[model samples]
Target: MGRKLEENLNFGETESLGIAMEKEDDEIYGIKADEMKKEKRKKKKIKGEEENQNLDFSESKKKKKKKLEESQTIEIPEKKKKKRSKAEGSSEEGNGALEILEEKEKKKKKKKGSGDGNSLENGEQKHGKEREEFEANGAVVSGNDTKESRYAALTSFVESGLPDEVLECCKNFRRPSPIQSHAWPFLLDGRDFIGIAATGSGKTLAFGVPALMHILRKENRKTSKRAVPLCLVLSPTRELAQQIADVLCDAGKPCGLKSVCLYGGTSKGPQISALKSGVDIVIGTPGRLKDLIEMGICCLKEVSFVVLDEADRMLDMGFEQEVRSILSQTSSARQMVMFSATWPLAVHQLAQEFMDPNPVKVVVGSEDLAANHDVMQIVEVLEDRARNDRLVALLEKYHNSQRNRVLVFVLYKKEAARVETMLQKKGWKVVSVHGDKAQHDRTKALSLFKEGKCPLMIATDVASRGLDIPDVEVVINYSFPLTAEDYVHRIGRTGRAGKKGVAHTFFMQENKGLAGELVNVLREAGQIVPASLMKFGTHVKKKESKLYGAHFKEIAADAPKSTKITFNNSDDED
Candidate 1:
């Protein structure tokens, strides 16, 4: 029994030991499997890093290549630009005129070719031809079909196509002035017209005869008892208005057309009475006319013809709003006529607004700012205080006899009165006209000046524009006016009606801003510019505005307005 028990215990011990060993082997196998899997994972990571490095290197090479190509492209254009600029410089220095002539010849050839749909080129050729013709005529005309619309300049009053009565009125005029000759046909054709000529160029008669003809042709024309003005003329100054009224009255008298003049600083009572009494034509300044129109004493509803004489001056005098209001009261289909000494941008804007889109524009001289070529412009640099002695000397030299008219212009109303006093003290027969004077006094002064009774007249810029005193042998500028344009007008006071006259201008240091423009004007008119004036650089500064100063942009009236843009926060976030 003891031996059997010992054997069984031994077998159980063996089996138990076998089971423990099996568990140990299994643990060892699991640890080896984990090590192999970790090795495989490490190998995969190394391969991924190597591939990523290769891709980075290739991408870097591509970027470098692109940069080099871009640099080459930029350099090529730079080199070409340098060559082109050098060529241009050489051409400008050597053969610019030859190039221009060759280009013109090419254009002429192109113009002779078949009429294609190239309207731009054709229009340019037409403009060139018109410019040539205008140069030949000693005038410059620009508009659509100006050549076709323009009539041959009338050499004789008989060819004026005017009524015998009207012709008789112009019998004293040796022949039509340049402006009258060119503008008569267009006006008589009942087309909208813009006449640009110097002052005293017979612009009054140019429009007057046509206006009279227009009125006479109206079958329903009212009689003197109930006559409403069929024509309206607007002037800038009261003097100009009165002058235009006088001319129209004389011309329309043979036709039994009564006219009335309306202006401020005078008795509106007479003007109102004349309106009530019935008139065929009404000539007035903007302010008084606007007052009369608003007062319901005047009616322009029947007016079929309108004239804006000295339109630029009217605008310059801040009469644009009043002029616009007056024109608004006239007939919409009215034949609009604008006669101005200058074709300024303001005048152009006004024409665009009121006149016909394709009106016949006749420029008797250059469209640029120009003085009357008949006037001899003499500029003298002197101290402001020295002007008195210089003026006395000039008067002695040019106005010693004082039989012919001598107009003296000053910068200010105070200066006009002071100069008049000085001249009076010097025992000179001088009368003064300025804004300070009463309308009656001014009228009397002008009458005396025109009649050559007081041949020496001291005045301000108010008399610079559109004052026609025949035989004004000399004009002396006691001081430069506020603008170069006014300087031109001041000199233009003399040398009118195809007569030679002299202008003596005194320039001071304060007027250096206009020195360049004055030089250009002198060169254009074939006058000599002083060396002292040329010391001021020939740079024309842009015109600054009174309201906006340097910030003012001279944008076109018809330029497109800027658009506003907005960004949404949500769009940026997206």
Candidate 2:
């Protein structure tokens, strides 16, 4: 039993030794695996180092190439600078420098042409320059020896060659406007004159003074039994005619000359009585004057001086026939004078038919349609539904005090009434003058507006042209006009008498047709145009004739009428 126990212990010891040997083999293999992993790590590190070096080398090469390119670009301008320096003394080098500048300009132009936005910006810059030039020159004179006879602008009222009485009447005026200064020399000299100027440029006094002078110079006026007028002034609207009469009467009162305003919408009894009593000047609209002339109550036999004010507006209002009839009744040797804010085709035609061949045409600004520079035009492009809110906002901003005179122009008569009612409901003091309103009411509204009794007035195009409301601070276009000319005249109600004004216009998709013209006007006046408006496109569609549609051919106003040739056939003669 003792021997068996010793053998079992030895067997157990042998088993323990075998287990220790297996453990030692496992450790040896573990060390080998660790060494293999270490070598692999070293290889990866070497490969990474090589790749980093290559990348750094490539980056350095790229940097050198960039630096070389930059140096080349920098050296070119330096060489040009050297050339410019040499060109100062050498004509040949100067030509080279000029060529270089020309190339640069060409490149710039090319770049500008590469984008539509840039091209539009260039156009704006060009228009801005044109406006600046016009403003700087003050007036543009054309026709009939303009170079020699163009009168120097009157610096003060004293320079105006007016009788003492007339000068006394003008004492309140600070200075003559540009139109008055330029037109006075021609008109007072008894020359047929065409004065094209912006509205509110003091055209009334420009022609009124000359008419008074014409009447005053006549020698046989004192002993004549006839009560015929010697001078006639035709206006487009009754309001303008009344305004002209007031001015002429006030001016002529100092000269012992009586003036009568003959217009419709008022009792004819008073007009006829005033005419029968004797008057030096007759100012009336075409329709009323034609009626009176046809009725034999008013006569134009002694009318030697005829003036058509706002001639374009009159022609636009279909007064051409009446105007021709009135002109035909006037003395053939009458001195014809026409003052227009625009030189449209129809106005040109009338001038051709009536005015002297060499009438002096004086344009105060550009002949093209342009807004008053004194007025700041703000155009907002918004949805039609948003107009009410936007208009309210603009009113709150522009007419906050509501003491200043603000004229709101709408498209239709009902729109005017609607807007007026809307403002009235908003707790605003507003008066409206539209066609739907009676003539008496219109006159009263205008009187109230002029007197500052009513600070706000809403009207259609009736009040747009030639209604000189003093101290009108703002004009808002609630609806765009059918024509751009009306738009100009509407805003022209403000910015009068050399005073600055503001015009806020609400534009919608419906007004896209006029967007181009509006943009042009704004750019010409150096006003900002919104991008949203520009998106409507800058193409101005040709105006279609109301009667002739798109196939109408626009003939020049000065073009001679085509003669209807009658063919005489030989067979018929035989």
Q: What is the TM-score of each candidate against the true structure?
A: 0.73, 0.73
- lDDT per residue, candidate 1, 1-574, as tens digits? 2223325445456334433543443354344655644643453344345456445434644654555544443455544645554666663323544566679887774443312211233433332233212322555444455566346667778787677887767878788888888878778878788777777778889899999998998898766454468899999998988898888899888888888999999888989999998888999999999998899999999899999988878988899899989999998889999987655566666777887555666666555667888889899999888999889988888888878788999988898999999988998889999988999999999999998888889998888888777888888888988888899988988787678989888889999998988988898899989998898867776775545566654432222224599976685565
Clashes of each: 0, 0
- Return the clash pairs for model 1, or none: none
Which residues of candidate 2, in runs, are more than 4 Å off? 1-137, 149-160, 223-226, 544-574
Those runs of model 1 whose alpha carbons end farther than 4 Å from true positions after fitting are 1-136, 140-155, 544-574
Please give the distance, in angstroms, between residue 172's alpha carbon in candidate 2 and its true position after superposition: 2.5
Candidate 1, 57: how far from true, in Å?
75
